[model samples]
Target: MSAAAHPREREIAADLRLRAARPPVARLSRKVLLVGTATACVAIAGAVAYAMAARPGAASRPELYAVGGPPPERLAALPADYAAAPKLGPPLPGDLGKPILAAGAPAPTMGAAPSASPEQQRLVQEGEAARTSRLFANEAELRADPSPSNVGGEPVVGQGARAVLDGPVDRRTVSPDRLSAPASPYLLQAGSVIPAALVSGIRSDLPGQVLGQVTQDVFDSVTGRFLLIPQGSKLIGLYDSQIANGQRRVLLAWTRLILPNGKSLVLEKLPAGDAAGYAGLEDQVDRHWGALFGAATLSTILGVGAELGAGYRDSAILRALRLGTSDTFNQVGQQAVGRALSIPPTLTIRPGMPVRVLVAKDLVLEPYSG
Candidate 1:
């Protein structure tokens, strides 16, 4: 029992010593680490300096080029006595070359006057005297008073004198070439109106025949009792479909007139009018604002899409493809916009719209008996 207790006591003592003893921790000092880092940096700097100092200097700059020699002479190294070939045409009879060569020579200085012959001197003196006499004569004429007979109360004017107005003048007066005598006693003269109403609708989409019915009685210009065009007469006409931008009127003309009794007359291209006597009919005008706005919006969208991500760098092929696509989109957008702009405004005149037949010329017709 003493031996077993002695072994247990030794074991307990060893465990106590192990628990009291602390293991050593490996910790690097901040000063030592800083010192080692500085040393390494200094060595690296020294190596860099040595490398720089050992490298050879750059090559010397090349000297500037000397000025070029003078150009070669034009006539140097040419054959001596190189005369021109003989001329193919004969010369003129007179010595015309002398005057031409003399013209090219240096002109004489004006320091001294040329010697003049006696006749020339006489001519010059006579001319001076005549000029002086003329000057004196003009002065006298200007100073002389007019005769009492010529100085009348009214001023005298030449027969060619005429009045003129010089401002921006236009032909305000026209000849009466359009005026004409009445064709017949039973005639509807110019400035006359035959009231009517549209029998068919007018759409500017396509050109087609239009129909109308006279709504009022038209009479001859000579007699008030004569009835030329009665009410309910059919008017066969055509309306123009060529619409322009912002245009709201539809031009139409009557070509033939048919009475209720079946009697027809072939009328010329007589123009249509409104109640106010204005040419063409007006009702509805469609400028297609929605279509225009849509086109503009589409163009803007295409432009924005084309310009997206344009700042980013890309490969040559990609860049080229992007530019091509951008240009294609841009062109398509522009074409779409242009096509929208080119669309003309639509003019519509609904049925039952009041219209008039303006008589541009004389119309001879038999009085309606029915």
Candidate 2:
């Protein structure tokens, strides 16, 4: 009669005691889970792309853009005819409807034949005739205006140049005359030359002074017996630093002359020349070709890189960044090229270059006692 002796209890205990050894069940790895998730995402993205591509719409129509939300489903109803609809404000004092209709009418074709009553045609013809008469009268008045007489009938200037040179040229008598007297016995007159050699080198990168030593003695023009300027005199001048493209000369002019005897003369912008009487000095010119070529090469590379960086599938942010970068590069390249072009050519004249001073006016000076 005890509970431990029950047959059902004994059977349950026997079932609990029974056990078996089985093989271990495998688990999914992190790599497999990640790969499965990635595959599902790709399939979903592909389905969405296909749906967008297959959407029904006219190609020529404007593309659909996202809005804040769908348009109100229950909008206020509009009247069947807008013209018959009631206006909110009081009526204007003028006949607004008539003016609107007239404005909307098609404009008359230019130069078309008149299509009107005979009276209107007559008025239009009279108006045109009056305008024609006025124009002709104006032309006649212009012709009748007083003008200078062409007595000698000299050659008429061509029509194209009439606007530029329409006035009568003044006539003056030019007489040949000789000098009443020479200004001074020691005068070094025009056409006299002073030979000199450059004492200081010339580099046309900036505006600066140039020095030269007189290589020979200069005598008076009248008698050629007195020495006006002594040898070894210093010539002070300035050379033009502005260089044009392909230019090979250095233009310089003497402004002062200093003699070895401690005397100086202010020469009036006396031009300097080479021994051959040509204006300006010939020397080496540095065009900065290396810098120019480098800028050009860099510009080409930047332009090419900008074009290569663009792609079809790029996002808006990437596209904007690319565009900004490209613009910056293009601007920088253009500026570099401009800077290279703006660099003036450097002209260099070595010392001892033979030069000449051509006297353009009389130089009255005491004969060099030395």
- Which prediction has the highest TM-score against the true structure? 2
What lDDT does model 1 reach? 0.82
Candidate 1 Cα outliers beyond 4 Å, as residue runs: 1-183, 309-313
Tens-place lDDT digits, model 2, residues 34-129: 999999999999999987895566576664986666655454465557896987754433556445444445656789665899999899889656
- Model 1 residue pairs with clashes: none
- What are the clash counts of all predictions, listed in order? 0, 0
lDDT of 2 at 370: 62
Candidate 2's displacement at residue 149, Å, is 23
lDDT against the true structure, per candidate, is: 0.82, 0.85
- Candidate 2 achieves a global lDDT of 0.85
On the 0 to 100 scale, the lDDT of residue 105 in model 1 is 57
